[model samples]
Target: MFKIKHVLLLSFTIIALTIAGCKSQFEKIRLSNDVAKKYQEAMKLYNKKNYSKAIILFEDLSQKYRGRAEAEDLNYYYALTLYKLKDYTTARYQFKSFADTYPTSKYAEECRYLGAYCYYLESPKSSLDQTNTKAAIDALQLFINFYPKSERVADASKYIAALRLKLETKAFDNAKLYYDLGGFEVSNYKSAVIALKNAQIDFPDIKYAEEMDLLIVRSQYNYAKNSIEIRQEDRYNEAITYADEFMESYPQSKMLDQAKALKADSESGIEHAKRMIAEFQKNQEKYKAMLAKEAKADSTNTTIKTPIK
Candidate 1:
């Protein structure tokens, strides 16, 4: 019985309030005046930098007068309040919605700009995942296309460029760690190659891109050339192969000239060793002939001296 009485009272209260709500100043021609008073309070909070409170009041006003022609105005301000308060995720949603709902409004272009800015503001630090940054770039580009004459177009483009540069720097930074760990010069797994490949993708025309390529080639060459010489013939052939690869890759490279010259010197050194062995054998035979002759002469001299004795 008590629960039934409570339900009846709750229904009555809701009906009464709904009636009063329809009769309130909000539902009258003086609605603009009432809304203006409420907005004045919100503006005070906003101007004082109490963005949280301002956002709360603005959102209440926006919801209360949802279908009113002025609701669009209140919503746009509410989005701005959220942005100022650093509530970027919802701010982006609100700004994007406001732009769509009020496409012909004077603030539509700015709404699009702020939508992109909200994403830009939420972008993570460089060390963190850059999904937001990339999203921001895409949104900002869309904003540019939709509002090409918007004052914020340049600013949005600027943010995208900044984000891209940061992302590229992050990629390069990770690649550099490989070089730092000494993995680039001795193994097929050197870091310079990975760095160069990504660097080309991140910044194809970047000045460091060429340098990265050079480092990769140099590391590969050094790695192959310096492999263990357990089998002289095997190792020599591998070295020659690597040296040839280096030459073909960087034919105009200064290192290519040095590599070719080294190969020639290695060949000459091997030939010189062969010639030295042949000459040494010939000299050994000549020495044997001279020794034989000397021994013969010594015997003659010895016979002369001994017989006389």
Candidate 2:
């Protein structure tokens, strides 16, 4: 009889839990349905071109079902609304979340692509922060990698090329900076190579090729002229390196003659400095006697006094 009572108690407990779970589930479904209904109404307004009212309803629906399945579509639409309203960052995150959660979705692909575009659309020109454009390029690459045959592949490639031009502009500017700075050994050399190579890659047939080569020549020439004799030899050698690059990359450059002349000058300047040093060393004894006399006088403990002889 006692065992029977225990069994009866267990049965009652199970019934109570089931009833509670059903109540909880029903509440969730009711809430989700209400939010979904609001989303539809907003979409209808949006279709009717009632953008402002549609935005309000979309905002409400999104808030109501914040963590539920019904929220997915609403979030995407919310992002679109924000984008239309010119609130970029919020739109980007909403689109980002949608993409992450629904990778296989048709809308997800668009979100993934457009999320980066949100950044790109706000991106300034090549003179400004290229951070957004770089990020967009990366995101586009990923999209292409994941969906090779997607219809958006062509569009992604187009953007990549456009962004590439921005990068090219930045590189050209850097090289120009070095040239303007009068080709200081460190700063000029640093930016020149970067700009030259990038220009070669992007506008191989453009005037930048010859322009960069000319810049390299001028800066390197001045650098070799002022450097110490031994260091000058190294600088001349470095200049030769630039000459070689020009020859190889821009064989037909109108600047080739100038580059060759500079190369010849570097070769001769190194030799002249070496010869001058050698001639100096040939008179080393005379220089040493002068220096020794100066050292002896400087090291003397006694001060010179006028002495009567």
Candidate 3:
């Protein structure tokens, strides 16, 4: 039993020593003044998929070899190392710089594509700011335009479509937010109508198109309902128009019943507004007649008082 225990202890010690030796060797290469040796060892580490140490060595080599012929390959490898480390933000800048500095290099096209792809990787969720998403779309489109016949054009187009869909989702959510706030301020209903319409225009093939149409109808109805009597008829007429269009477009929609109800309510509201306007005009004529009669009586009294003088 003692012999077996000693063997186990010796095995663990040997394994630990080997790991320490490997780490020391890497540190020696990192701190060494031999630029060629460092560059060779960095390539070995990268090929072995040891990015953490490879990136350190590559970064140093980039500065040591600047403006030299070796710098071109060093910069490309550095950018790739950063990408493998999942440092997309830094990777994108390095890739773009490499392409700009070495426009005639054989790797220029590849670096440009990688830079644009890095932006795609950095795109945030739909609920977050979409600046990165827009930038990604622009970068990818530029790649396609620069290399129209390249094999990567198809991939670039696909990424642009995905980014556009994300933007569409954000727009849909924003317009729906106004609708959700409609109860707090009646004017929000009008804002929702305008926003949703704009979304439809921006994303003609949007996935949420059906939902947006229904929301437009509902928003117009509520907007008309909250308007003043004099403006109600025109607003309700607009509501009816939107509802009619929704029903025609989505004949088999689950929201068809809701759209139909809005149309009926808008028609009823228009009739009510017309009746109120007629009654208001009739009362206004009566008021004017009363004022005229009072003025005539005062004039007759003034004439009689002046005749004696």
Best by lDDT: 3
Task: Compose the digit string of candidate 1's lDDT tens values, residues 114-206.
Answer: 889888888888788889988999999999999788778779889988888777767766665565555444544345556657777768755
lDDT (0 to 1) per candidate: 0.72, 0.76, 0.94
Cα lDDT tens digits for candidate 3, 169-270: 999999999999999999999999999999989889999999999899899889889888899998999999998899999999999999999999999999
Q: Which order, best to worst by TM-score? A: 3, 2, 1
State in Å the error of residue 214, model 1: 3.3
**Model 3 accuracy (lDDT, Cα):** 0.94
Once superposed on the true structure, which residue ranges of model 2 sit more than 4 Å away at CA?
Answer: 1-41, 48-53, 67-70, 182-214, 282-285, 289-309
- lDDT by residue (tens digit), candidate 2, 201-244: 76665445567677777667667776777678888888888888
- Cα RMSD for predicted model 3: 4.2
* Candidate 3 lowest-lDDT run of ten: 300-309
Q: RMSD of candidate 2 to the true fold?
A: 16.3
Clashing pairs in 1: none
What candidate 3 gets wrong by more than 4 Å, as runs, is: 1-5, 248-254, 274-309
Write down the TM-score of every candidate.
Answer: 0.59, 0.68, 0.85
lDDT for 26 in candidate 2 is 42
How much does candidate 2 score in TM-score?
0.68
